[model samples]
Target chain A: MILAVAWRNIWRNKTRSLVILIAICLGLASGIFYMAFYKGMVVQRINTAIKTEASHIQVHHKEYLNNPDKKFVISNTDSTVQIIRSNEHVKAISSRVIINTMAQSAKTGTGVKITGINPEDEKQVTNLSTKLIEGTYFEEVKRNPIVIGEELANKLNVKLKSKVVVTLQDMQGNLTGAAFKVEGIFRTSNTAFDKASVFVRKSDISRIMQLDNQASHEIAILLDNNENLASTNTSLTEELSTLDVKTWREIMPEVSLVESSFGITMFVFIGIILLALLFGIINTMLMAVLERKKELGMLMAVGLNKTRVFTMILLETVMLSLVGGLFGIALGWLLTFYFGYQGIDLGTWSTAYESMGFDTLVYTQLPFYVSMQIALMVIVTGIIAAIYPATKALKLKPAEAIRIDL
Target chain B: MNVIEVKDLKKVYNSTEVKVNALNGIDLTIEKGEFTAIVGPSGSGKTTFLNMLGGLDSPTSGDINIGGTEIGKLSSSKLIDFRLQNIGFVFQAYNLIPVLTALENVEFIMQMQGVDKKQRQQRAKDLLIQVGLGDRINSRPSKLSGGQQQRVAVARALASKPTFVLADEPTANLDSKSTENLLSMMEELNKQEKITFIFSTHDQRVVNKAHRVITLEDGKIISDDRKNE
Candidate 1:
């Protein structure tokens, strides 16, 4: 019966009840949505860098660490790749050869850093073939050609089928050169990479760089799970004595740091909302006690123990908080899921977002556990706010309480 | 035997500037099942007297023995238990909880007293009916009149079947007609249930109708008198 009375008391004043409820709801929504988006974006950042750029690990010549420009210095990359492919945990591998050169066009000239790769094997490690914009991949024509970055292509004033001379020094300090047609154009996630980098056939690199008997300077390794990247990198480092193995984080420190910073920022954001809601709920309960001072005092006079009065007020607070929190969680979850599905692309926000190193389309996705845990946190926060108000109500003097007119 | 005994009852509130003695050693006694009234002007310690007897307030220096227990010396929690089991109170403002219905309000004290479900419902229903509020069982305090609300409070006071009802100017907010009706109902309950009714009031009509009247002024009793039945 006391519980019934307590429940009824909370709803007697509609406006007060609503004010408290909205406070709790807003708090829960802000916390839940921020957590969901922050967690999702962090995972997305790691995966994108791992699968589309760094791969799980990259194996480079021990000499490459000191001077990566060393040519014709590969130590049978094919046998090493075969050894890695035999491992069940290994996902894919691509051999990469890069040469710093200058390209001259009819209208313009610019310095270019060209990466030589086997299109078939490269797709396995980096999935870059799909990033091609104009013309087909060079593999489709069975011809050795160069794929230029957007910035390089713009500077050279070249389009599909444009021709350019790639000039550079080969091994043994020999000056050598190559000519190739532009077969395709591609964009990198970060525009800096697109501005300076170019792609070429791996066989052509061996022929021009005078390494016909060797492969590229490094090999990129990928795994189905980016979570395993660090462990795999460790294992490879232990097994390979002549080469250095680097994980995605070590290869891309700046990007990984952003992920960590984003995570901490999210936690702080939610903490502020949670703290405000807790106090809001506590304030509402205190107001309730003040408003009903006379009645509470009378209850004591009529043989109600102090414990019962305290319990009634606490229960009232919990009911108000939890119900409000649930409503807010629903709204936040709906919004999170809707945005997660269709994703708010940064396309229109391109100029601004590009500076932040993200693509035009920024997709959003959240882990199921993240959203569920946030809802549970809402309930806990509500319970915490119930304490002080209950204690104050219990300490009321029965005589003075009954004396109050209202 | 007297159901209540008060001797040399004194309470002093020591503030920063001075001590305000609310009660200056009141001496009184009431026999079992008696209907008594304590009358006093404002600031004359009528409320202090009631609080001391109900175990809701402690006397600074006094002896209050009610039903064989020295209530004035009990701890706050023990006093609460004692009040729940032995004393019922009615306040000047009716003090009906606005959110509870008449039935729920009446059932509240019984719940605190640890009465079982069926017993609480049956006893509350009986008391509300005795107070002539049977039809308004589902009505909250806001939906009831001053007299009706006071009657519900009275029913709540009696729910635990306490040995006595301590009413502190319970009719202060009621209309004359409602006050008359309330006093008559309380009188009927006192006669039928043989439970004591102790009221502190300044209303002349209330004291005139009482079987015993204790009048006070300036924290001291001026007269203690009883009337023939």
Candidate 2:
């Protein structure tokens, strides 16, 4: 009966109830959609970090990362690669001869880090082959074929089939120069990575620098699934204690920070929205309680206890909030679904977004648990908002309330 | 047997600068199966005295023993339970829960008593029938007229099977015909069911129908008349 009374009581002032209901609905809907949008952007950035920039894990000579000197190469790379390949989680691995050098085009010259890789092995480790804006992946140009980024190509004033001279100091402290024709121009989301990096055939660079073909500076590994990244990284780290083995998270801490701090950011964002809606709910419920002052007094006079009275008010407020919350969740889900499928194109700001390693076209994504958490938060907010008004209702003196003119 | 016993019942309102005596040294007793009226002009303490009798308010100095229980000694929570079990009230404005149907309004009191649903429903229906609101049981209070709403209030008051019903100006908003109808119904219920009724009113019609009439002035009982005596 109390439940029934509370349910019916909310409809007493339809306009007032609906005003607050709509306020909660719109507030939570926007909050939920914004959460989904941010999650999508972060997930995309993480995916790009792993697939394009850093494979699930990377292995390098202990001092090669600290000092990218060509002399700090990992010896006996074949035996180390064989040991890592035996791990069940290992999907693909590519050894690279990393050389920080200068490349000179006919029009200009700029500093560049040349990644020397086996084309076939690199295909499985990185998605650079698929990111080609023009030309083939080390296929069309047969002699000293190189892949450069669109940003780097623009900087060098080079186009497909353009011959660029790479100048570098070899392992013997001698200046070496080689001519390479651009076989591919790839454009990744990270403009900085695009501008500073170029890839060449590992055999070509190793032979030119008089280095042993079996020795390389870095080994990049891609796992079958990122969930296996930790176990595989630990296994490889223990097996190859002589080399530095680091997962993508350790390799890119900024991206890792964004992924880990997403929950707190969401909490603060939705908290602000619910905090605003909380006062609106309180004001509405207080008015409802005040409007029904005489009725409440009569209820007490007729032997309705204070706890029951308080519960009735609480129930009314919760029902109102839950109804609005459910609607908000539904609306938010619908918008997320629509935008997630079609994608929200930030084409106008694509340059800025891409410069920061974010895809311009984002597909909104939220885990099922996140929506459940938001629903729970809404219920908690409703309970908190009900407190003051319900307490006020409990304070009404039955004798005086019954006699109240209104 | 007496259902309510009072001794030196007094109520004082303490303001910033004045202490106004609402109920001054009053004494009264009401027996079972009696229909009584407490009448007075405004500020004569008729409402305050009724409030004390109903356990809705505490007297500054008094012993109100209703059915072997000293109400003033009970905690606020226990006092509410005492009222639920022993007293029923019908306000002057016919304060039915506006959202509930007439049947629900009547059943609500029994619900508070934790009565079985089927039994309460049947009793609510029967009570509404007795109060001449049988056909309008499904109508909410707003849909009912002032007189009809009052009838529902009376049915609601009787639904708890309380020791006595306290009516504070129950007929003050009713027309003559509705007043006469309501009085006739109360008179029949008092005679037939032995349900005690205590009313605080300025209505002469109610005073004329009561078996006993107690009038107050300046917070003191000025007259006590009994037609049966």
Candidate 3:
């Protein structure tokens, strides 16, 4: 009966109740939508980084990371590649001859990292062949063919088929220069990476540097299933203790920092929204209780104890909050899924986002756990908001309240 | 048995600058099944006396014994429980919970006592029928007439089978016809069911129907008269 009365009491002031309900609904929807947008952006950037720059995992000479100059190449590339390829989880693997060097055209010169990669393996591992903005990718060239980022090519004032000069130290510690034709111009999502990196055939660069067939600086791996990353890394770590095996998170700690911060930031945003809604709930419930002071007093007079009175008021507030929260979750879910399908395009801001390695189109995704978390948060907020008003309702003395005219 | 006993009951209203005596040095007693009226002029403390009898307010310096229990010695929560079990109250405004139906309002007291649903429902229906509101059991307070709401309030007060009911000007908001109807119905309940009823009112109609009338002047009872007994 008390439950029935509490439920009926909410509709006593239908306009006021509906207004607060709408406010709660809109607040939750906006908060959740913003969180989904940011989560989508973070996920997109991580995916782009994995696909374009770092594969799922990277292997380097144990000392190459500490001293990434010319002398620290991995010595047994074929054996290492063979062992890694035996793992079913390894989708693609490639060995690279990396050198810090300078590329020059007739007009200009700039510092860059020249990466010597096998065309076929690099295509599967990093998919560099698909990012061609102009020209062929290491194909149909008899001489030394190089693939340079569009940013770097523009900086050096070179284009496809333009002869560029590369200066670097050989394996014997002698500064050597070689002339190469730019066979491809690639533009990746990251402008900084595009500006400072170029790629060449590993055989061609290694022969010029007088290095053995086994010499390579880095081995990149792409996994068939991203979920197998930890197990595969642990297995590879045990299999090859001489090499340093690092996941993308370890290779790019800044990305991991951003990913973790996104979760915290999402909760903070929701907390702020819920806090604002908390005040509104408190105000509405306070009015509801105060307006019925006489009725509440009569309830007390008619044998309703303090505990039951308190429970009645609290139940009303909780019911109101849950009703509004469910509607808000449904609305937010609808909006997120609809936009997630169509994609929200940041057309004018693509360049700014691409510079930060984020994709222009954001696809919002709200996990089931996150939705459940929001439901729990809203219920807690309701409970907290009800406390002050319930206490006030319990404080009304039946003697004074019944006789008091208003 | 003496259902109510008051000895030198005193209630003083201490304001910022004045201390007015709302009830002054009153001694009263009433037996079971008595239809009594405490009649007084404005500011004569009739309402105060009723409030104290119903355990609604505490007297400044007095002892009130209701049905063998000293109400003044009980804690606030204990007093509320004692009142719920021992005394019923009917307000001038007929303060029924507006959201609840007439039947639910009558069942409210029994529900608070943790009575089973089947028993409370049948008892509430019989009581509503006794009050001539059986047909209006499902109507909310807002839908009922002023007299009907007051009858519902009476039924609710009697739902707990209290030792005595304290009515403070219950007919103040009713018309002459409704007032006559309510007073006679309450008189019937008093005589037929042996339900003790104590009222504080200035209404001549109520005072004429009461078997005993205690008139107060200046917060002190001046006359205790019994008629038609």
* TM per candidate, chain B: 0.96, 0.96, 0.97
Better candidate number, 1 or 3, judged by lDDT: 3
Model 3: per-residue Cα lDDT over A242-295, one tens digit each: 999999989988887888797679788888999999999999999998888888
Question: What docking tier does model 1 reach?
Answer: medium
Residue clash pairs of candidate 1: none
lDDT of 2 by residue, A195-269 (tens): 999999999999889999999998999999999988888888999998999999998999999999999999999
**Best-to-worst ranking by TM-score:** 2, 3, 1
Fnat score for model 2: 0.78
| Best by the TM-score measure | 2
Count the clashes in each prediction.
0, 0, 0
lDDT of 2 by residue, B1-229 (tens): 9899999989899965799999889988889998999988999988888888989889899899999899999999999999998888888883798888999999999989999999999999999999988899999999998889988988988888889999998998899999999889988999999999999988999999999999999889999999963
The global Cα lDDT (0 to 1) of model 1 is 0.78
Question: Number of the top candidate by lDDT?
Answer: 2
Best of the two (2, 3) by TM-score:
2
lDDT of 3 at A144: 97
**Which residue pairs collide, candidate 2?**
none
Error of 2 at A356 (Å): 1.0
lDDT of 1 by residue, A1-406 (tens): 6667768877888898998888777777767766666656566666667766778888887777578666524568888887777766788889888777788777877888778888888888885678788876775545558887776788799988888787888776788777788888887666766777788888888777777545667788988776676677777777776777888888889878876686467556766787778888888888888887777776776666777777787778777877887798787788788777776666777766545556555455555665565656666776688778777777778877777656
Which residue pairs show collisions in model 3? none
